[model samples]
Target: MKSSIKDVVGEMVTPFLEENHMELVDVEYVKEGSNWFLRVYVDKEGGIDIEDCGRVSEFLSAQLDERDPIPSAYFLEVSSPGAERPLKKPRDYERAVGKHVLVTVYEPVDGLKEFEGTLTSYDETGLAVAIGQKTYRIPADKVASARLAIVF
Candidate 1:
């Protein structure tokens, strides 16, 4: 149910975001306590501001109203992904090169399931992450999750 909602919202928002030169980071539909919430995370070349969020919220709200895709009541939220942004797309991985990142894999690469280091390179083959003096080659398909990490 939640997954379908997320998918519907993603389809509705993609064109709007692309038209505005913004990137859709993620869409989440979840229940916290008694209330359901729909969250949309967006970003740009630099960063997203409150105004951008408001605009997205407004646009998405209108679209949702017109489509009525959701079945129940839910609060809609739109915002930036923040510092530790998830690396979900290929462009995200490309932008993450040379940045500090935390990555998790479905299986161990070099006997490790988790990796934290400077993402040196991202290619069709895989990723090259340098942790101290050693570099680990992680298959792209093996990545379960990835996010930008703060050094401090």
Candidate 2:
């Protein structure tokens, strides 16, 4: 159900983001306590501001009102993904090269499931991350999740 909502929200926002020269980071439908929240994460080359988020929220709100894909009441939120933005696509990884990141694999790589360090490079096949003196080459298929990491 959560995945379905995310997909629907993604579909509904793609054209709006493109038209506005923005990029869709992620969409999440989650229940917190008794409230349901539909969160939309967006970004661009220079990052997003409050105005950008407001515009997206307004557009998505109207669309949701018209379609009413979700049956229950929910609050809509649009915001930047922040410094620890998730790397959700190949382009994201490629753009993340030279930045700090945390990657978790579906299975252990070198006896470990998670690696955190600087992203040295990324290509079609895999990515190389340098954790101090050691570097791990992780195949793209093995990655379960990846996101930017704050070194501090």
Candidate 3:
């Protein structure tokens, strides 16, 4: 159900995003307590502001009203992913190169699943992160999750 929602939202939102020079960062549908929330995360070269979110929300609200793809009631939220956003796709990982990042592996690598440091490199094969004086080369397949990290 959530997958279908994400897919539908992704398709319906793309044109609107492109027209506004925004990028779709993520789509999430989750149940919190008694309510269901549908979140759309968007970004651009410059950071997104409240106005951008409001505009996207207004556009998406109209589209959802027109299509009525969702059968159940849900809250729609459109916002920026923020500075410490996730590195979900290959392009995301690629862009994070030379930036600080946090990575979690599926299984322990060097007896640790979590690591944070500078992303020296990321390619089709693997990722190299410099943790202090040591550099660890992590195969991309072993990564459970990766995100830009706040150095502080």
Candidate 4:
């Protein structure tokens, strides 16, 4: 692949999102049965609405149409990441401090591969997740995936 279709879309979408004061959460290109899908996740400070999604979808659709990066046809979808939004970047982790989160590590930390609790702190060292009175320091490089956890 030539830098990946997802990367291309990201490059194209970043400027548009930045101009609108929105952030790009993720971009996914996948095949579901006989159909292909290009999904774009975007968000803003106060959250986004359907109108925002529609605008992003339209903007991305036009850019993709002009670029024609993908050889096959694909449905384009733009939407929010919702309450369980992923924590992919440092800024995301920073914003997630004091919130409930679920983090899965590449290696076990304190005999556990996953941790679900309130994120007390996040820094260059990694993250400090408080599971009740206990806190685990997860190394930055050990994080496989992390997302906000919805409280019941």
Q: Which predicted model would earn the best TM-score?
A: 4
TM-scores, all candidates, are 0.94, 0.95, 0.95, 0.96
Residue 130, model 2: lDDT of: 97
The predictions' CA RMSDs to the true structure, in order, are 1.2, 1.1, 1.1, 1.3
- Expressed as tens digits, the lDDT of each residue in 1-152 for candidate 1 is 77888999999999999999998999999899999999999999889999999999999999999999998999999999999999988889999999999999999999999999999999877898999999999998999999999998
lDDT of each: 0.94, 0.95, 0.93, 0.94
- What range of 10 consecutive residues in model 1 has the weakest lDDT sum? 121-130
lDDT of 4 by residue, 14-80 (tens): 9999999999999989889999989999999999999999999999998888989999888888999
- Highest lDDT among the candidates is held by which one? 2
Itemize residue pairs with steric clashes in candidate 1: none
lDDT of 2 at 120: 99
Q: Is candidate 3 or candidate 4 better by lDDT?
A: 4
- The segments of candidate 3 whose C-alpha lies over 4 angstroms from its true place after superposition are none
lDDT of 2: 0.95
User: Which residue segments of model 1 deviate by more than 4 Å?
Assistant: none
- Span of 10 residues, lowest total lDDT, candidate 4: 1-10
CA displacement after TM-score superposition, residue 57 of candidate 2 (Å): 0.4
Among all windows of ten consecutive residues in candidate 2, which has the lowest summed lDDT? Answer: 87-96
